[model samples]
Target: MRGSRVLSATFGYLGLTVAALFFLLPLLWIVVTSLKTPEQLFQYPPRWWPEHPTLENYTYLFSKMPFIRYSFNSLKVAGLSTIGSVVSCSLAAYAFARLRFAGRTALFYVLLATLMIPYQVTMIPVFILMRSLGWVDTYYPLIVPWFFGGAFGTFLLRQFFLTIPTELDDAAKIDGCSAFGIYRRIYLPLAGPALTALAIFVFMFQWNDLLTPVIYLSDPDKFTLTLGLAFFKGTVVTRWNLIMAGAVISAVPILIIYLAAQRYFVQGVALTGLKG
Candidate 1:
């Protein structure tokens, strides 16, 4: 039994190591390629390390592309969207989890059903609406819709809310606190982990979003980082080094946010999953 347990542990470690390498290999390659010279980018068999490392690719990308502008646009849209999503989704989730409204359950289910519908199905109509509203080429299309509740965010927060004891609600009510007061004073404070997780998710989604921005934005100055990065891939030739450099830059914010909120993100996911 002891020998069998040791063998199982050895295999488990080996499998984890292999999986780690599998996931990290692409990231390693991206970093290495970002540091390589243009000539080294096309070398046969590919070198893991750059033969002649250079900062020229990053310099060229910044000088040539409106990367700073793109980064700012992305951050503005993502930051506002995250705030809107949190506020709207939390309100909706709180209602669904605590309040007793007529048709509440049915409405919640209907909202959930919308998640099953493909975004492609709604894309055209949404675009037309945006065009009609004269919001095309504006940040409104990307940031405004987030004010409305999202099904997934609402669901996640609602599940988290449900886990909170009703006794707290009762106690707050006895103190003459209204529904909004209870939500603000009692539950919201305790829901830190879930809110952080949702914020990170919303921020990442908005930051990485390409299709909505592409459809609405025609001007180069308003383009997000994802679109700006595409400038490196022209029809005739592609600047691999520049593209990799841009990709590395684009991934940095996400990495920093994940590292900062990783504990809460994991705990929130686990708590929500377990309760749900």
Candidate 2:
């Protein structure tokens, strides 16, 4: 029995290692490619390790483009969107989870139903509305909609809130606490993991979003990192090395944020659906 268990564990570890490598190898290649010179990048046999690694691509990327401005723009949009998503979604989730009201379940179901409709369906209409509001070629279109609570964020937080004991709400009420007071004092404080998870999700989404930015933002000054990266592609010759370098830079913040809040992210995901 011990021998069997040992063999099972070994296989499990082997499988996990293989899966990790499968995902990591491409990222490694991107980093390796970013360090290579243009000459080294287009070598005949394609060297895994550059014969001569250099930071020329990164230098060229910074010198030729307003990379810093793009970074700032991305930070602005993602940061504001994350804050908005957390505040709006948490409030909505608190209501759904704790408030007693007519049509609450039906309303929740209706919100979830919207998730089934793909963004592609509403993209054109939303753009038209933005254009009419004179928000085209601006950050408002990118950041403002997120201020309204999203279905996914609301649903995730609601599930997490449901897992918390209702007795706390009752106890808070007995202590002369109002609904908003209970949510602000007890629920929000205890929901650290869920809030962190939601913030990370919103930040990552807004940071990496390409389609929405592409549609709304036309001016180079307002371009996000993803949009800035797109400029590297030319009709005649695309700069793969520069693109890879920009990709590495863009990925750094996401990696840092995820690593920092990894514990909360895992805990939030694990606990969210426990009661639901």
Candidate 3:
């Protein structure tokens, strides 16, 4: 029995290691490719590691374009979007979970139905609205819509909120706390895991968003990292090395955020749907 258990553990570890390598090899290759020169990029037989790694590609990327500005723009839009989504979604979720109102369930179901409607279906209409409002070519179109909350975020948070005991709400009410006060003091503090998870989701979406930025923003100075990376492909030739470098740079903040909130993220996902 002990021997069988040992063999099972060994196989489990081996399988996990193989899975890790499967996902990591591409990222490793991107990092390696970013350091190679133009000549090494298209060698007859590709090199796993560059003979002489260089920072020239990264330097060229920064000097040739407003890469720093692009980074700042991405950060600004992602940060604001995350903040807006978290606040708006949490408030909406609280209402759906706790408040008594006519047609509350119907309204939530409508919101969920919206999630089934593809963004492509509304893309043209939304763009026309933005254009009519004179928001085209501005960050307003990129950042403002998120303040209204989203279906997925509301649903996720509402599920998590429902898991919390209503006795706490009664206790808060006994203390003469208003509905807003109960949410701010009790629910918000206890919903940390769900909030972190939602923030990470919203931030990642905004950070990697290319289509919205392309549709709304034409100014080079306002380009986000994803849009800026597209500039590396010229009509005549593409710079793979520079593109890889930009990809690495764009991936850093996401890695940092995931690592920082990984604990809460896992817990949030685990506990969110326990009740419903």
The candidate that wins on TM-score is 1
Q: How do the residues 1-276 of candidate 3 rate in per-residue lDDT, one tens digit apiece?
A: 999999999999999999999999999999999999999999879999989999998887788767788999999999999999999999999999999999999999999899889889999999999999999988998899889988888988998899899999999899999999999999999998889889888889999998899888887888898888776455216678878888898898889988888886676566545534
Query: Residue 121 deviation, candidate 3, in Å?
Result: 1.0
Off by over 4 Å in 1: 267-276
Provide the global lDDT of candidate 3 against the true structure.
0.88
Write down the RMSD of candidate 1 (Cα, Å).
1.8
- Displacement of residue 236 (Cα, Å) in model 3 is 7.6
Total backbone collisions for each predicted model: 0, 0, 0
Candidate 1, 1-276: lDDT as tens digits? 999999999999999999999999999999999899878988998998877799987887787767888899999999999999999999999999999989999999999999899989998999999899999999999999999999988988998899899999998899999999999998899998789888988999999988888888889889899877765466216677777889999999999988887886686567557745
Q: Tell me the lDDT of candidate 2.
A: 0.88
- Computed on alpha carbons, the lDDT of every model, listed in order, comes to 0.88, 0.88, 0.88
TM-score of each: 0.94, 0.92, 0.93
Return the number of clashes found in candidate 3. Answer: 0
Off by over 4 Å in 2: 267-276
Candidate 3 lDDT at 191 equals: 93
Query: RMSD to native for every prediction?
Result: 1.8, 2.1, 2.0
| lDDT for model 1 | 0.88
Candidate 1 at residue 259, lDDT? 88
Q: For model 1, which pairs clash? A: none
